[model samples]
Target: MAYECLFTSPRCVFFTFTLLNQLLPSILGATYHSHDVTSDTVCNRYHKRELQVYMSDPVILETRPESAHMLTLGLSLSCTFEMEAKGFYTTGVVSVVQSMNFRSHGDNCLDYMQTIYEDEDNDMKLKRKKSKKKKILKKVVKAAVLSRRRRDTDDEDGRGPRICGRVLFGLQVDENETLPPPFADPLPPTKPDQGVLSSLFWDAPNPYQSLVSDAAEVDHKGEIKTRLHISNRMLRQNEDVNLKVVYTAYQECDGRRVPESLFHCGYGLCISRSLVNDGLVNCPFGDCADEVDCASAKEANIIAKVLHYERTDETSVWWIILWVLVGLVLMFLACCGGIFLFMRRRKH
Candidate 1:
């Protein structure tokens, strides 16, 4: 009966660990509690761990003081889970849900997580044949029932909203950091809006009391799905590793309700959220604004180190340059001496 009540009620949220007390970016000032899920906890048939959800509080995005020009109107959640796949099932799914007390009007929400590594059995991906095949797929969005679709699903029955999406991350943990060094991928940017603002209406005069009276009729919550598949080849029957899970939120009202998620390249330009770490160089070629700290980039660095192909230190580089210069000077002098001898012999 308690399980049934938890599913039926909106106020009672689920978490693996204790609550996280922190202030998230809001259109108006608001606070949120963090929740967690792990492999050991059982919730549903489709997922291995229970859903990590943000407490039912409307975090109104407001204009940050430093960036007064940018008024934020939506919230984002990032969840980190310690993953060990020894005795547990070889495959599992990790889920995170973002429920809103107010109505959300667009498809601006997307999910991302740490990258999983795939390579040959020798050591790591250090010595795979050079091929164009991608080792890991970082974007995990299999099936998502967002704002509108979720509302319709809830109407049919009093049951909780059905939320499902793509597998999050697939990993193989070993004693050695042989597992691909985990890194966060940037969430894709939302499409540009028409620069207009939509009117957001709420009931109670106090922003806090504006929470929807009926939990079943709520329309603005979404679930992010990710998967972890452990391989017997990589683990030693009782090994576990830690991985990161990230969730990004965007609100695409007609006007700029929330600022577009952008990542600063540390250079002069700010690129779209999707552009960051998408593989193709969007910012300056070597600035590494979009490429550095990415999963693929970090993995490549690790592979290079393992293969003994990493770049040499600056001192070694300068020494090589000096040797080349000295060699060039000696060759030039030898050529001059040979020309002088040839002229003298011809005259004689």
Candidate 2:
């Protein structure tokens, strides 16, 4: 079916006109023969008159580069048959791409033409770039899948065998960027041959002693041991912005939980039912306020923690000086210990 165009449609006119040169960017010249220059021309020779804009611009025209803030208008040259709305009856319609350049010799023409040219050129460039990126991503995904399949077949390559495919077209053909290393075999999944006690730390007197950890699967009475690990994360963030005053006229309870404190106290109001009988907590506090069967304490502690745990007292800190001193002392002792062991071995 043949599609018809109105006088207002500049795009249809440009598209119709540019198809003449076997798909090349249009050049500025009068000799260019196009399908658009038929019985209707921009300059009417027979009537000896300037073209009449029979009506307002076309009803719909797409602006290039959707996010383009500036409007780039394309001009089309065409003659009309029957100009409706303005009411004129003509025999034919002209469809040709028209340029806005006025001067002939210098850059004024070049600059105007360049503006239109570059806009279209850049639009095509961006489209090509997006298509290229999508292709690269698809290739990467395919390579990964192929690599996984290859690895599943071969174990001799401790590092999994690489899967490779050619990138059909690329900006840098010879630039060899290697694929990322394959995923490492996860430490035989660390089945945890022995369990660790979070609350009770190992304090060994022997420097070379491998710390022994004993976890009872069953209690002394032979009852089934149900130990739940309760992880309590503490974040004591103090806001300097008098934020409490900003949020409300009076001050509220800032959340400050000491896991070690709770452990030291042994019993407290349950902040979370998850921690009720939970045997383990990742972060332990030194001491916590003892629960006196107080109803409000549970509510108060919860509100404080959720709002933001801000402790009035010192919590966890890694002291640089303390660690340095400890390290130096340990080094000196280690040297002495090594000397003693060597002397004993020599005597034997």
Candidate 3:
């Protein structure tokens, strides 16, 4: 009966983790629910492709690595993406990985992990999870057993489960797999001062100024969609003599931490500055006299537009004051009526 009631109630019925339980108190109105992520992670263009990529490879950053975008496991990778979204993570030597399309799957996972510790009992914490489903545990053991036999058979007809960590042969390979140093990943050889760019790309709190080694820059207009750093209003209004732009990278495990090492983003030790003002990218490719001089009224209109604000907040404190006054008046009337009734009872 209890089990039947659980399913009947909306609280217990959830697709992934998008559940609202009547019996449980949610933290800050945020409910922890499991979401299925697969099809939602990648586009349909990669439907037929199978990719063989190395395990433990860093996700490529520049040009948006295919591995970074797609969500898959060995079985899920084999099958077409079945769901809209999901929240599965992988464990690595230096990082735990999370990937998704529209939403922040990483922080959602981290927040869920934090909820586990809220119990205050240390024993209740999660150990590393090994299996994605009930059945995979058996396949993993079988694969291990097969791996041992591969040494004797010459790996031709009947060796074992040939599960290359990424995928099988002729599968879609994401070229943006990040290979780091010690294995000859193409990066500018690091000098003593070369460590500066590390902070910029990693989770360093501030941007590194005075870059000497990395000078080449890519100022993209409407090309780069994922904005790394957003400038504060103070930086824009203060009009500092020179404001520096800091480009940052999100950690695969958590968006907060500075990655110990980053995968391929094309150039290593590249000093990058975030471009904010349109003026920085407004270099018109033309002749000498054709350029409109910005020293006139046209420049004034441009300046005016920058300073102009189109929207105004509608709320005002006067409404609150009026409501409070009405509440006090009603309370006073109730008190006077109570006193009159008490006097009439005493007289009677």
Best-to-worst order by TM-score is: 1, 2, 3
| lDDT, candidate 2, 158-237, per-residue tens | 22211111110110011252222222431121111222321121110111011110110101111111111111222124
Model 2 lDDT-worst window of ten? 241-250
Candidate 3 Cα errors over 4 Å, as ranges: 15-61, 64-348
Give the whole-model CA lDDT for all candidates, comma-separated: 0.26, 0.21, 0.22
TM-score of each: 0.22, 0.15, 0.13
lDDT of 2: 0.21
lDDT tens readout by residue for model 1, 54-164: 221211111113321111222222322222211111111112221211111143213222211111136433433332242221111111112213233323322323222
Number of clashes found in candidate 3: 13
Per-candidate total of colliding backbone pairs? 14, 15, 13
Q: Each prediction's Cα RMSD?
A: 29.1, 40.3, 25.4
Best by TM-score: 1
What ranges in model 1 sit over 4 Å off? Answer: 1-221, 231-234, 237-240, 253-348
What is the model-wide C-alpha lDDT for candidate 1?
Answer: 0.26
Q: State which candidate, 1 or 2, has the greater lDDT.
A: 1
**Model 3: lowest-lDDT 10 consecutive positions:** 109-118
Runs with alpha carbons beyond 4 Å of true place in candidate 2: 1-290, 294-318
Please give, for residues 1-348, the per-residue lDDT of candidate 3 as tens digits.
454333333443342123221112122221111112122222133452111111111111111223322222212122221111111221111111111112112322111100000111243222212233524544544344344331233234432112111110111113342222121333232312323423322111111111111111111110111111111222223222111111122112221332443222222221111111212111111100011221221122211011111113122254357546755764565566667667777999
Give per-residue lDDT, candidate 2, residue 195.
21
